[model samples]
Target: MGGSKKLIVCGGLFLTLILSIGATAPKGIRLGKASYRKVTISWQAPDAMTQVAHYKIYRDGTELGSTASLNYTDETVQPGTKYTYKILAVIVGGGNSEFSSELPVRTLKSASFENNQLVEKVVDSFHDTPKSDLNAVSLISAIKAGFEALLGSNISFSVIDENIVTSVVVEELNWINTVTPELTETERLAVQSEIDAMMDSSFAGNSFDHMYINQKLTQLGDEHWGAGNRTAAELFYEFSLNYLSNHESTVSCSLARLAYFAKSHLTQDSSCADISESLSKAKACSERFFDFFPNSAPTSTYAKSALSQPAAWYFSYFPKMLEYSNYDALFFSTAYETAKRLVAFDPADKNAVQRLKRVAAWELVTLQLRFVDEKGNARTGSVKICNVSAENGKRDLFHGDAYVDEREFTLSNGTATVPVYAGHDYSISLNVDVANGNKLKFELPLFKYEKNKLVSYDYLTNSFTETPSSQSRTDFVISSTAYPYNLRADRGIDVFDLSWDWVAPPSFTTAGFKVFRGNMEVATVNKQTVRLPLNNSANEYRYKVVAVDANGNLSSTSQILTVYPGDQSQYSDFFEWMNRYFGDSDIYAGDDPDNDGVDNYHEFLNGTDPTKVPGPTPYAGPRGFYELTLEWDAVSNVEGATYQISRNGTVVGTSSTTKFTDVNLVPGVSYIYKVKQLTPAAAATDWGLPNTFTTQKAHNYEHADKVQ
Candidate 1:
């Protein structure tokens, strides 16, 4: 009975295996012509299988290797090889289904005359077909031939309906709507005809009303307003407007153009009231245009231009009336806002920054002067001022002692005083540094002085002078004439040598001096001669000279002297080599040191030459340890040598050696190593190309325990 049970159990297992194979059978298969030299076979397995171990691929009854994915490529098959392939779906339970239906496949071959000749013949025959005999057959043949040609040449082609083609062409010509006045009558007529035809075509909806309205508007916008049929153009534009009143986009564009023309033509009119009304209408139209075409570039540009005009018109009235106070506030506000917007729109707009500065200067006329002492302490002084009533001008106030109170003053402690004039130009000077001989002399308008009272002459002028007061007032004064020395080295020169001429003011005698190197004052120079010590390693250096006067008056250091190193004669060669061989500057500086298993410098110091060619250095004993000895030909003019060893492009060790034996390396592994040589001048030679070697696998008896 026990023997019988064993037999039944074994039979049951066999039956289960067969059932698993049947359940895991592939349900579908597919094939496609993807490329040459390969064939793809894809299959879908039955859902009853939980895990598919692999699909066994077969061609012409020959078994190929199995893969887990449903898709497989028979890469080993040669091009033009014809075969029938099927898949055997295998389950993880050691069972597989029978072969799938055989699918015929042939690998692609190189182009031959047979394929091209047939396609050519077909196309030529189709083209030769009589027009009366033209049919689907000829059309299909021609299309197929074209497709074949395109595919073989690796080019792309697409088929589109007539509607898309017409739309593309019409949209491309929209820019012609804005023609310049310079266009001749013939050119204008031709353009108008073209626009009419495009609008009348199916592409633009064949709307005759739209075409008529557009033509009328275009006539009004063409040529110089007064020169070319102004009456007729106005009539057309009016008629166009009546029809396009409800058409927001068209109506807005027409109104804006009309307003622009009116403004330009009525510039010399006795009254600008009508022009202002036209501008208001234009602004309203622009608002409507924006609503209709919010993202349109042309519409947005028109809106911005329209908005800018009203402000300009208002400001123009003020200057004409000479009502400076009334218009001053308006001008300042408008200028400020416009400048801010311009800056926000185009951060790099220098014109906008300059405009802002000008507006700020206009506002400076309202500032009051305040005098301060050496410690920024306030001082009591009476200033008499006067103003000059010119357009954008102010009167200058003078003191009883002939000091100009209209000017701004700067104290030695860094405080400033600027006079204010409402609408006139005033010359204001700042009394800088009173206690010490240092003084800052600057002249700014009452308005501009507020913004920059400490500087002399608004950053644009020269020859600013200040007189010292005998009242024993403590103020910081700056000399008007301060010229700093500038030094720059010639290119390709590694070291910089510099000298300059210094002239001291007659009122001030030279007391002590300091020479500045970088940010630190390196030495005191009583005499003019000074030698600057520099490390040739750096590319550039800057120096300055500080001079002190006898009365404790300190002047800012001389202008910075810049020095550049190296006579770049070798730059061309260096750049050429860098481009041709290095390809990248960063690549040469990568951390890989040695061509061997060591750092380049370390290898050199260990008596190993880094520039040596790499080869196999095998160990003689157990434990798979080997020492590699690297050596190379000595480079001429090299004072001493440093070496690095690299394994597989990674630094593993460095030594000063003709050869280094690497003992810790594993056997049976391939390694690529290279070396670099360092010269006495600290320049490094390019690493030699790598050499590859594979260590022999250790014998089991050599290190039997380690191997196991």
Candidate 2:
């Protein structure tokens, strides 16, 4: 028995030695490419080993280090130096494996110099030379070019280098520091003469070059003006005037200031006539400046001030159109209108407004009347009308009869009766003497017996055709008593109809108008006049107008105007009707009816009803106390849908229901659920339809409930 036990122990020891040797032996090894900076050495241990102890790393013939991992890296090496590495697997049994295959490594060098040269060449190609070198020019030389380039390039450069270049130039000039010492009379006069010469030369021709030079001169004038060197400043300012005389610009304020200064400096005994003339010219130039540069702040403000000067100055310049036979009334009218424009341009100017009112009052009446001789011949005279009375009993006094020559005059032939207040008598008296040919001449009594009645007389034939009565006249005639009676005659509404006139009849002078339908007034416009509003609603309309005078005198209503409005519904009906006439493609069709994801027709073949909702809920789960997750196949017929989950017919949660989950319910509570699919049409329409699903009751383990 002892000998058998000894043999078994010896065999077991031999088998243990063989297994330990087999476990430590290396099975397979790998060597990566040497080009990479770091190399990885890996080896697999024999299958006979249960666990690996560590891996030994060998660099060339030396052992670098050892780790428990199966792979190792050899990091210590010089650039361009090749080194060989291998890994050895060590087992827990106190035996080691042989080295694996070798890995050769060498470090990478820096990039080539040719790439650096290419980058330098690209940068050099993009760099630009200095502008001065490219153009071969100085600043002043560049400015002499045309305004297009002057304002575009030169001003751009100045704006960019504004702080640096302007400061340098100003420092060199020392302009502010040179204003201390008093100059002798002779020296002052010399400087003033030079300034005047420069200004005169700059304004010799009308050009943009002259304009730029004038601007520079104005700056110099401002400097001299600030230093109290009035004479020099005056010279520069006079140059500005010359520039403006033919070439208007946004810089006329300088000229106006010079004129004002010159006017202010004159003694009281100085010729008012000459001062008036100069002021007139200055005002005109300022006005032109405002018109040319309406958006300029300085010019507009200066123009407003310039226009406020006394009216005598402007009146002195009024053209003597009536005095000279060669001049027409139209010419004087245009001049008056120009002055009115100035008044309108600056409505805040009190002086301008008052002057305009005075001038317009005289001009409006003078233009309205025509003077004639006793034989019914047109005569030229300034015979003005004064103390004219209207039907409302208001009287206005006017400056009259400034005739250039003496002439016997009477009212024009066929003059109609002048309208006046009913039941009132007017006394007409001439201010001329017949005895001395200048004494108070003739007096007559004129009466208006009733309202809306005509008192007609012919002065040329000395005949009384019709006297005022209760009756009204259907045939209209020009009344000598009214201003602009003949003015509206030429402005009939149409060639075929001589009824309505563009210029309002003197009967409707002051108040706005009202349009009435039969006896009812439809619209009342409270302005001086009314323009008919256009209608395009496929309807016809007729309109009539009546005027209310300033004194509350109502005129007879005007004739009617007939017009038709335009149409749109036919275009709107075209789209709807097209589908019936031309079929499906003629009109667009939207998604199918049925809330199912698939179209109605498609669901028919898929064994699913499109109108029916998807599969049952709680179909395969317990009644309660069970975590649940739900998912459904994406529906095609619906854009989006909402889902609800319920327990025992009570809703627990709701979702847009693409997915849902339920958790933590009572052990014996039965639950049921339903899902509905909703489909929506195009954004312009309402939702299409909905489909629904119902689930059976489910219970927890304690209750045996059927799951649907």
Candidate 3:
């Protein structure tokens, strides 16, 4: 029996040794590329006696997940955060290895780069061009080439080649001086003076230097133009365009100026390009500028001059027109209604036809207006186009005539289309009558549209704005009030899965919802639920939801909800500051739970319990017949604290020593005083307690006056 037991023990020890040898930890664990939202960690496969099945990843001392590959990407990461990661390899059989050495990784800090919507809009607008035409292709290539030169180049924001830039500037100056037709003596001196001034200014080898160079060239061009020196003006303007090539609006402005020069002067000189070429270049740049910055196109100084010339010049070149005066009216019509006529008018010149169509589509947008009642039910109403003011210094579209300027439309259904000229602001009123003979009028002011679409209104910001997921829903009468109801939040270890039901009206059909963290949009989804990652460093977070319909109209945002994630034990500071004082009560920063006249924020700043209201303890009495004295215990555990004494609710005086005296008081009269402690240079706390006191009456009067 002893021999059999020894054999069994020896066999068990051998099996354990084998298992230990088969399980091996991952080796050479290192970080791959890390971005703002994700971190990639890779490791060399471990050498195990059995085939490896998978690898396990642990982040910040917890198991994140298992991956079958050697590299794993942890997407649940925040920007500018540090995390510890470790890896372990598991054999195909069953045994797992010990954790690998912990590796510290940090995600790249985030900044405001080019937003996704701008990129999409730029690309989409570019694709709208005639790809087959050589001129169109070259124009598109120029845009792509511009981006490549800026982004693909080795230029660094932190560094610049000053010597090279100085050399280029000197070469440009020399070229300007050696023009074939030398400037007049006065012109020469003036140009030299401007050049000297430009040389005197500092170039800081940064983006500001680029701006300075471009602006100086433009200024020189303007001066020459003002002096009627066309040659010098052309020279400076061309150089300015080259300097501002990467700047969309400024470059477009330069191109537009050159185009105008070509048209006005009909200059076909060796240096001045032909009218068609100049206008074509201007059209391309202006379209790009408007596409990327639709909001700023109306107000931008560059856009005003850049976008105003293309459509008119292109239309003027057409063969046969109804009349020169009717061109504006024809271009303002809807693209769908005018496509056949426009195409037939210039079928041979496809490029011309396309250009006119593009400009017309961009210039005049068909704004869709939806009128609804308080419950989102469609309401029939008349929209009177009361006023229209052009931003680019043009005459108003409407005149005093009701059919011309003061146009009104009846909404047969709840929706109607209005012609909104681009670069113009409008004031329109919607008049709707309710069931009880009551009429409602909504006057919308400073409203504009772009590319036949109205901008989405952000209730959170209470303004017009755009995001990648937020589409233009057109203009609407009923303010979105269908807030998401019965919202529920399920907190995971590092995420919150939020689910809510829409108290949607019958007329509302939800297309998607935008999720926000505070004022920042976190995510957008088509469903009523979203799973959002929580910042491990922060215990509390605020979130809200806004629903969007198929037409892009947004519902009123849900009430801001505050949530605390993870177990309470994780945040020791929260416990020490909040739980220790309030004892398991859920307290918000803005709430005054104790009705102490001080909000929790001030209570926290004052280092007082939010749940307790300090009661007044009368401690003042009369010192003499007409004088009163006040004293109180000083507040403890606070540094540089002072006291404010109030007499009858007015600040009588401030005391640092906790003792104050009131003199010149009427005898037998009571005076109320309130005392509150204040921290240095901070908001004052609530009054602790009110103390009332009366001065001693003059009981023993002098037995006799002067006569007695």
Candidate 4:
């Protein structure tokens, strides 16, 4: 009986759910190609709809001009916005069906065949260079090719996208533009002109050939669909290998790539391909570059180049051997023998021997860095890295300018090389005061770096992985030019009303802003703007902002700005109040001791007591129209008190009630008002506040609504 009752309850609940849903969601909803700033969505009518009056379309939850058909043409969207669309079936009887399935789309930038070939030319040039002289341009160009090859038909600025490629490009451009000490106005303008021209024509005209893009998309689809047969490490390693390999690696390390692929493939199905011969070929090839040590004086730059540049490039694929199931042990035994040979060739080759051991152990060591922003967009600047003392409790790794001069390094192209010490802990720090001036430092674990590897921190997922961990820096500028503004004090207590529009920090690790008046930090504010208390006699103020990253890493930026003190807002009235009530040096306009949102300076401007909370209501309704009528939310809690209203500092009227009328004020002019509550004892009614309203010009009688 209980089981029957439960089944009945379940059946009733399912029926209720079906009734509430009302209609089935549309099937076969599809998004068309969205490459040129337009998208189309189509779907079949839901099977549940009956007597459908018309179909309604919605974009981004808002109607983008509804349609009565089953499809939508959205032409108003840009490349930057990803739009989602859905359809609903509205009936003649005023009821509506459940919304159809949603389809989201975003336009992708395309490049022409010639542009693609040109990109290949750049990559070829980069790949042909010797590793020592092969700057970021070579590596980045190669990586760019890899991106075009491996990136699926997806639009995102993720770690897996082309952010690393563009970051290098931006770094190179910045290096060209920013003069080490400073850039003059003329030089800056010249660089800016060049950049504008390049943006207008150089990159904008490029688009991928449709067939080629389709081929890549198809390839990506195949790989993704078949990825379940492999391990996550193997899949990720394959992606890394495909993205990092250029023509040179393709030609020379063909067996290496194939053997690695086969090794992983054989784990699932051994009957597919014979990889034993390919694996042997790869081991023999790896031995060719295993003997030379770049750190030692092996006069043969040829041999060093073979090992560190082209050869090291090839051997870097050695990690995939470990990622394989069977080939790892097989490859490690051979690599260990190669290490023994290096020690035999040079009895003093301790480093080479250790590297061999690392090769066998699969240890990670920092080889290169690609600095980027919090969004995984590459950054172009110098970063300070330090080797923290294993003993010192201070961990003073990156508080302020420690080893800035000694360990300072800028990315080449968008990369920098650091010596790999197998077991040493390191820290990278920078000042990132873009939002609120701050400094941060990130401590790195030695365990994270694999031998001859790169940082691959994914900004999209906010995750870190060794070997291709996309490195990033906080987006911030500490100089004067960060969204500058004019500084004008209220003259009563030398408190300047600061309204500076500054750049927001790109990272989430910032603590607050530290305001410096010349040499000393005058105040700290976490927000963009704060009332800065200036010296009574000083005529100008200079401020800088710094940003702090999550790992306490700090990024310092240029671009400074300065604002001079202008005429006081209330030069006459405020000074008089301050001087008459207390010494001019004691009470400051910015000081709000009572924790009211209204500052003491604004209080003096309105002749209200600053010591009390809710002191003489601060700024009431500053809203409403031409020949404007203004109103306020009345102050209660006071007993039998009347109110005094003032317009433009002149006593206009007094009412026993909380209402007033100011007639015929000139249009297009500004007016200020204040209200004070009056007690029956005739004491200072000390309630109410100041507000401002400006009248608009009279409208022509063209439109009946009369709204501007």
Candidate 5:
């Protein structure tokens, strides 16, 4: 009588087939077939309604079957059995009409259920030795149709696919989950049509297999963001046209030959000989274009007439690898001119259309190749890139080399804005002038079509990093840069103090040096100092620097610097030395390589060994506006010693002198404080008495001075 807008839930899974809508009665209830072991119930939807979502069938009084279209067949009936059927029309606006008058039906005494018995037989015979070739899918569909015709909806059945049963339910779940969200209404309709075709008995056997492959091909296109209803034939047509777009008769003819060969694998192999021979002869004509399309020849020749009918040969084609690499102009005024003449004579010529699309997609297939420094700022350069071989499922094209480096393009402002076809593979490399002879450098592999159109080659590493998911994310330094000056381990920032600094010789001419971590150039530091972020505290890293001149020449590297917890101060002499190279080091100074509470500078100034911590108290100076400073009391005059001060157990500042100013405090809140001194040996002095202080409280809300 009534229905609510509910999620289509059937049995245990979600069903989307029926859109049960408003109440409106269907007319002309009738029994189409009544026989033993089978019964068919039918009804007529009113002609007034423009859309009928489905018909919900009810048996006796229980709702059971739901069919998207008219008619239903019930095969579960026993011989000589009688049954009653009623139908409710489900409409698009989430409404269900009243049930139609019941149709009384009976099973005949002699009706045999051959499909049902065949399913049972297949299930019983399935095994691993020969993986059951029996058509269980069709048999299941027939059985489902029979049951759904009467009482079952959301009908799905599976048998042992092999010795190991394939879980069809899981496959269905994945299918629904992967596609439902992205499926447009049109796409859904197309998918449904494919599904309907699959269950259609007319498309049985190999024809059905071909349909399934084409459906998946459409899905592949969808996955890659291709739009519209595209058929396999259309894809092949576009592919072939891309070849003929060269406007060369031999090029077109060569591709035509390939297509003819390819079609044999797609359809009946024996029937494709004429097409294959014709393409061969066409290639021969292209080679002899001067003789065949002579300037003296009449325009109304038999050859010209046949050339107008291009559709017959223009479905798909590919030039041989040698032809692709030749790079010479072809099929122009000679053979290609003849093809165009045919096209002008016949616009609907399938050959002409296919050829033009190939030309069109040529523009579509190519994407920009960008080159930039690790920072991704565009730079100019003559970069060479090799493309991985794309056999297009036919490796015979690339005989000797599996991959070729034929693709080479220069950068305009660090980007080659040229388009390349899909499935092209890229390998980046460039020669550098070094102490030795020029070495062939390489970059990471960038697969075309698999990656976005704008691919990047980093300047520092000469490699490709990750394919950035967004344009903004590519701004970060994923690669490294070279830096100059002897890198000395220095104090890090903040309390956790996981950061480490690389201090180099300061110079006004220092444009910036590249800072490298392993093979990666992490950053180009304009200043003489750089700090590692605390996030990398867990990972070990090798540090080296090469200063860059104003002219951008990198000087000789100073030496490799190593850091591990508990070894920050072991290399202070090497770090402190100018124009010096330090090879071996267990630690460095003025840094918290040990990750303990205090820094090396504080330990040095507090008359404590830079290697030990909790040694001396730090003295505090007068606090200033918006700044709090703490200094290590001059208990020891260790060279390059510094002080660390904290407010209520939180580190606030570091100073080289015995006195330090503390700034930026709340006006009213009282805070307890502590201080520590550090030295060149990466030592720290801790355990200073907690001194409590209260700042002047603010009374006026409007004054900006009170906020700081």
Candidate 6:
């Protein structure tokens, strides 16, 4: 009975194993022929022997349907939406296969090809309005229409689209006519006269093409504008506008042309009336453009470009006009009002912010200056700060120069409060008139603030010896130095462990140490050590340390220590490589971060960065004489890295470079191959997506009838 029980248990284990066997999942599922609204997915059958009734496709975990064909077109996909897909083979008899690897696909976004004609229609509806009705809305519509129609589908300016060749030629003609010094005013006028006569002849029996006439007149107007002939440019622009104003397609171009003509009147003139009239015209056109285009629209960039010129003019002349402010404040006041209007329209404009910053004198930052006596007691003195970044008499015509003059401050209890410009550099000195008008002027190091923050600061030194205040304070006043020293960095696989030495000054306790990478502060640590992650691509790093006392007093910064990394540690472990590249050690073995179809563990074994899309996959092609050649891109970053080539799930050969030839293959046999990058430390690499090629068949020589 005991023997019988042992045999039965062994039989039961064999039956369990046999029952677990099922169909295999589909192989080589990949995208093909994708579009904005549709995507086609194709895959190979699990095997030739397995009777697959159909292949089941799942999108985002929902079963779409089953298809007998090898490819499926997903027409229900939405534009710009990302979807996950997986495939499984349904066996003919009973059990189904496991799901294939998930493929994440994103559909393309729609191009900017719609609703453009609607903008044109809006311009045409208001084209016939009276001069009194030429408000911001009507003018802006014309500008938008003009810019888009002139550029014609090349709004991004990446490439000059062939469709806008006519417009480009017209612009080139205008450029040539203006900059050519050989062309006389009489000669230009004669040509304009002939064009005008031809334009007028169009109403009669014989006429020039209205489009040709319009383009020529506009070109002449642009030439005149460039030549500083404002009156001529305005006359030509008006003539050009009259010809095209009635046409739906050219109305916006006409209006924009006229607006540019008006703006051409702005010149460096002493007369305030001339300046105001030209500025008002430019401001109206620019404001109209801004009001019409929303920030999120693609055309909004053109609007910003339009407004930048006027805003720049405001900045250039505002200060210059201040010189005349003493005679009449109206000049400066008008410029100020224009600035307010521009800011009110688009507060996010960067040019407007710069103009305001320049007009407001400077960014104000309140700084505290501290001092101590030779006895280590609070020393009271007077402080003087010199504006080293400013010129003596840089006056603005409109707004007076608001330079920060050198001033003296009284130090109370070892500290004095003073106001300084944020971005301006300054040199400071402290005077303690103690003995017979004997003044000890401590020459302070120059420093600066930006955006109301103290970016850098250094301690003061006496005139006798230019020693740092930290060391000088120890010799003259304070008893000890608190700055850190002896900073050492130890390189790890993915991190650098930084250790330093710090000794607190007398009566001062350690608060924290600020770690700086170059001039930027990276971290604040209470301990003497910090572990910073290493960047794999960077070969070296510079570090400095500064100590903060418990009383919030900062010491002098330590000497900069540059650390050069030794050997790369990512090659030591797969997880280290993943963490170094992706900043994620928790990534699963099968995760594809860059969506190049190869998973992480395979990527690690192959010596490729999981965060970056890898280069070309392996290629297998059948050569004549029953042989196959396998080729792949060589892995460059990993030193001494080779490739392992496998055929039909078995290791066939190893290559130090990128190519390997396989011989002694069976004729007419199809083989699937996989290639993996192998570093010196890599023991084995797992299989990934496969590439297949069939060997050339040998000619059969045996006779069928057996008569010979």
Best by TM-score: 1
Candidate 5 wrong stretches, greater than 4 Å: 1-380, 390-403, 406-420, 431-442, 447-452, 455-708
Candidate 4 structure quality by residue, lDDT tens digits, 266-337: 332232123334444444543333322223345433333333332232234443443323244544454456
Model 4 residue 46 CA deviation in Å: 99
- TM-score, candidate number 3: 0.25
Which stretches in model 1 have alpha-carbon errors above 4 Å?
1-239, 265-285, 288-374, 377-524, 528-708
In candidate 1, what residue range of length 10 has the lowest lDDT sum? 14-23
- Per-candidate TM-scores read 0.27, 0.23, 0.25, 0.25, 0.22, 0.25
**Cα lDDT of model 5 by residue, 517-552, tens digit:** 666786677665666542244364666767676878
Per candidate, the number of residue pairs that clash is 99, 13, 2, 50, 67, 12
- In order, candidate lDDTs are 0.44, 0.40, 0.54, 0.45, 0.43, 0.55
lDDT of 6 by residue, 272-343 (tens): 566656666765655544333344232344444455555555545542343311222454454455555555
Worst 10 residues of 4 by lDDT: 14-23
TM-score of 6: 0.25
Residue-level error in angstroms, candidate 1, position 696: 89
Candidate scoring better on TM-score of 3 and 4: 3
Tens-digit lDDT track of model 1 for 238-345? 444533343444555676666555555544343545544554454454444445445544324444443444434433333322223333454446545654554454
What is the RMSD of candidate 5? 26.8
Report the backbone clash tally of model 5: 67
